[model samples]
Target: MNTSLKTILTASVASLFPLGAAQASEPATSGQPDTVLIQAKKISAPNVDGTSQAAALSASSDSAALLRDVPGVSLYGAGGVSSLPAIHGLADDRLRTQVDGMNLISACANHMNPPLSYIDPSHIGSIQVLNGIGPVSNGGDSIGGTIRVNSPDPEFAMAGEMLRKGQAGAFYRSNGHAHGVNLNATHASDAWSINYAGSLSEAGNIVAASPFKVVSQGNGGKPGLAGDVIGSSAYKSENQSLQMAIRNASQLLELKLGLQNIPYQGFPNQRMDMTGNRSEQLNLRYKGDYAWGQLEARLYHEHTRHSMNFGDDKQFWYGNAPGMPMDTEGKNSGTLLRAGLPLSERDQLNLGIEYQRYRMNDWWSASGTGMMMAPGTFVNIADGQRDRFGMFVEWEANWNPNWFSQIGLRAERVSMNSGPVAGYNAMAYGNPASPLSVPGAFNAANRQRADHNLDFTAVARYTPDSSFSIDGGYAMKTRSPNLYERYTWATSNTMVMNMNNWYGDGNGYAGNLNLKPEIAHTLSATFDWHSANPDQWQFKIAPYYTDVHDYIDAVPCSAASKICPGRKDGFLNLSLSNQNARLYGMDVSASALLLSTEKYGQFLGNAVLNFLHARNKDTGSGLYNIMPLNAKLSLTQHLGHWNTTAEIQMAAAKTDISAVRREMTTPGYTLLNLRSSYTWKQWRFDAGIDNLFNRFYRNPLGGAYLGQGATMGQGVPSGIVVPGMGRSLYAGMQLKF
Candidate 1:
């Protein structure tokens, strides 16, 4: 790593230790660096900082892939940038993800524009993952966890001085013919400062390993196999942001504006691809310190216009399916206020209020020559709207040096409404007298729904000495269904519910009006052991369990229902519902200095292990798309201005799968990766080769291969497992001034 990058990594690792006892003292100076911490009080939850984020972004083009190695966290591959993250088998809307204190909603029905895709990796200052458990004040309406991505803080010059700084970098990769560039510049004065960042990236179809092949049957009854390419997996995107900050004696105010444009992107797992995406965002924030304590307030808004349609690959699969063009628009706005107060010498309290409003519409245009009509069909989710308001209070106390505890409570109200819906051949499934005519009845009735939910958390830490500690927590979390989950109104039997296809099961589905909220009860514990010196060696282990009531699932629909069109795969029609579920998992990690010498420098070793088990308790069936047991081991060496690392990643075969969904099984494989860096003055260079051995493997959670370019053997199933990437070489250079 470069000297500057090495400094950042060191600082991030040091932050994992206890603040007062582990941090080294620094000499007072006239100029100080800008820093921001975003946790609620002191809690005993397992969390991972941004070190992994920095490493992953440096090596790959997708930001969501960064979480795959984090303990207790896994990824559901959907596209290059739209991968959905899962914790303990829960994913998508079940988790809360925010960028710079703003929550962004995806406008595409297939979720082509997830929250993480809105922020470029070059502008990310920090990323924090609260695994399994999170403070009530930080988030609500989530049972999984929270992911926070923050931009670099604005900087102001010291008294009687002005400062200017900037950095430029570029990178290229082989397997996908991918390349990208990023630039950042900032100017600061005594009272005001300005900052700007921009990035551009593009990639072609990804190449699979040589041993991995896609067998397809052509229109002529001839079967053919293709090698080393997953077609239609291309994308291009651009992002830009500007920020301004004003500072006074004890207060600071900041404003930011961001713009994003994505002309096209392919999804190998979804039925439709992203043809266009344009978005704009504005945010305003204030931070102040007073006699009572500290206060932070923020207001933000985001708007997105997205379009999706069948790409060339898809057009080849379904030749005369008509040009299915769909357009969607979304508007999101929110406000937050939080304050901290000191009650006494040993007690403190934090309180916050939050509110958000969201609106969305989805409609599709006909090809002018389709099966039933000439003009078009509308109302996938006409005039869909959701509003939420929440309040939370938390208290932290230090009974003594060895014992610290925190307790918090949160309450929220969620409301949803939508206008009338209509589709092609509505009358076929819309008979009002039929018991299965919910879709038709919903269109006739004005739909309005509301839910009141509550959550609580209690955590404590016990430490007898500086080298060891025991921490534990218990939490109750709740989440109501999203707008799409309750308001997707389409009568086409073959219209697979794309929003709910995160698992890539290749099943058609529809929404339910009577679905209830999911409530989760969880308990977690962690044990930490470290050397007395606090810098040589360390080990940490965490175990967690959760039981959820009314967990979301899919079940067979009645044959007479309007949406019960059978698919080509011969699977029965399905609808969303709630069932009881259980999940338990454990994470183990360790790091140590193996050797140190003045002549050879330092050598370090690190390892991690993760395992999880999930099941639908009510039906005695395994959960879909759960990650198999996995582990990773790595070694690092530093000498003079050069740094190098070697790593091995391994996973066990997965057989446990949901019978109803007909989930596929995968065989295990191991991979090797190597990376190195060199720095000189203000210039740095990095190079790495992933999958060094050119190994061919299948990722159990990688989702099914729905790409149209590939052909399958006659009578072969459609749910073929997608293969991992082939060997690739990457190089990057950065210059700072």
Candidate 2:
């Protein structure tokens, strides 16, 4: 589905219909889940101006990019399809993201495949983001907040009629010669329906406005790096899914099968690239209405086989072997049950239970026969397992016509364990003079661990009138460390440590087995004011603060550890440690009706500003990768079937960086974008020019440039920030019948 910030900021609160509230919606269900109600919905069409920007939004494959304009939301540059979203000041595993009610986890050490990359943007029906104080039922195990993405639901036909509909669309961008195509078809009777969605996307290395740094070149692609191109930024992906559903009045059952294959995908921030990734999913769901309320149950299984190797720009040979091949396999199965209970006109209760089982095995065979390449296989994570079981209860009440409240509590148990591991040359690798190999220490340590976590939240809303309302809440959340954070054992060899870096900073990391779970306490509030008629004007501001105990920050490797020694100054070896952290942020947004006339057209304006501050309270140091002050301004014009928008996006220079990591800072810059759409009959077309002025600036959060050269052990050049994309014109068309 296509979405824009204009729709989200101006959406009405009536759409907050509880999942099991009063009625049943077949294809278009309620946006808010029973236990989650932050009231931010991604509407498909642009209703703010009575027009749509489907053409411009669907031209890219990255689903995470859709949140670019969202308040307090930032993107971490990765593969073409694998960008990670950072809410507030936290990113990665800190956020609870679900796809079609399934909690999927990244199985790679480098997190090359994030949950958002599993589904294509063209197939997304709606996206809901609770970028604030979310209730416990929204989920446990995360602190950044929650995001739910769903695909279009099956549509049934009239009483005695048959239904058949299909849509096809394609898009292309001038930069990197990016292009893709999508197809979806639906067939249904009164009570039965079948739907299919498939898409293919690919792109070459993207170029910057100009060369950011000078580096060695070998692939003979372009000047500087490759036409000022970011090496290893190419990607190719295909996805297909089939869903079958049957419904009898208020009851519905569905079965969905999904398949995904990525032949090759490059990353400008990381050293290794995704050579192959194959994934399959089977999901079954049941939902029905009973006398008590609504009941829902789901069971799913997902498997992935992933491989990493040198891409087009990175070096391929390592002394003897043509390439260093790393392989990983992961299996995940989960079950969820939820029940919505109605006690009275003003009271509602939501109860849920969830259980998940995950198994993973990561290993790299001996290769190259070099100093770092031993003769034995290197087992990164052998037979690793993490199981989670949780239950939650949430209560909602409308005390009167003007006040509403919700409270939730969740409890869960997480059990993690892993088998023994061995490094290359299991015996010879251990340095007797200094200390035993980390493998020995890791194998001998007690890897089995269990954590009983609890989460609690309380929120209240007061609306004295239709023009103004205020919402405030406090949340206490808990999150256990991911498998990679506690089980990665290699630390002696820089190459091995390099393989474990997921932050894309050209640094090395090792996991700390004794790390504790992170606990966060957040306080948030939102004040909204709008004209009697929402379309006429609106304004809102939200501010939030969070304090975390045992935050997972990294510390320089100490000689006392005796495993990893000889740390380099620029590119140091580090270990994950627990530290206290605090973060605060605020979002201010305003929208207004600029002008409307029969002779001309309708004009609307919207703007948003965001500011963030984060610090490691324990060490009095700046946190890493925190987004800087940023803002967006847009003016949209609408006339009959034609719509156009001009946008300006800007960010402040980044100076508050992690001193320990020797993080590099970036200079701020601004760019303009122009987009337009036109619709006729059953067809719609969209076109846009990004970086209209061809601005040259670096992405503050893009991390170091490690896309090319010999990246095995500091041979690749560092201290270069990844450059932003240059000017590019893109266009797309869609038809429905």
Instruction: Give RMSD (Å) of candidate 1 vs. truth.
Output: 6.3
Tell me the lDDT of model 2 at 600: 74
Q: Candidate 2: where is the Cα deviation over 4 Å?
A: 1-53, 219-224, 431-435, 559-562, 567-569
Q: Please tell me which predicted candidate would have the highest lDDT against the true structure.
A: 2
Give candidate 2's error at residue 354 in angstroms: 0.4
lDDT of residue 672 for candidate 2: 97
- Residue-level lDDT of model 2, residues 221-286, one tens digit each, is 533365488889999999999999999989999999999999999988887999999999999999
Q: How far is candidate 2 from the true structure (C-alpha RMSD, Å)?
A: 6.3
lDDT of each: 0.73, 0.79
Q: Give per-residue CA lDDT, model 1, range 290-371, as digits (tens).
A: 9999999999999999998766555433334455678889999999999999899889999999999999998776545544
The 10 consecutive residues of candidate 1 with the worst lDDT sum are 24-33
The numbered model that scores best in TM-score is 2
Angstrom error of the Cα, residue 118, model 2: value is 0.4
**How many clashes show up in model 1?**
4
What's each prediction's TM-score? 0.90, 0.92
Error of 1 at 128 (Å): 1.3
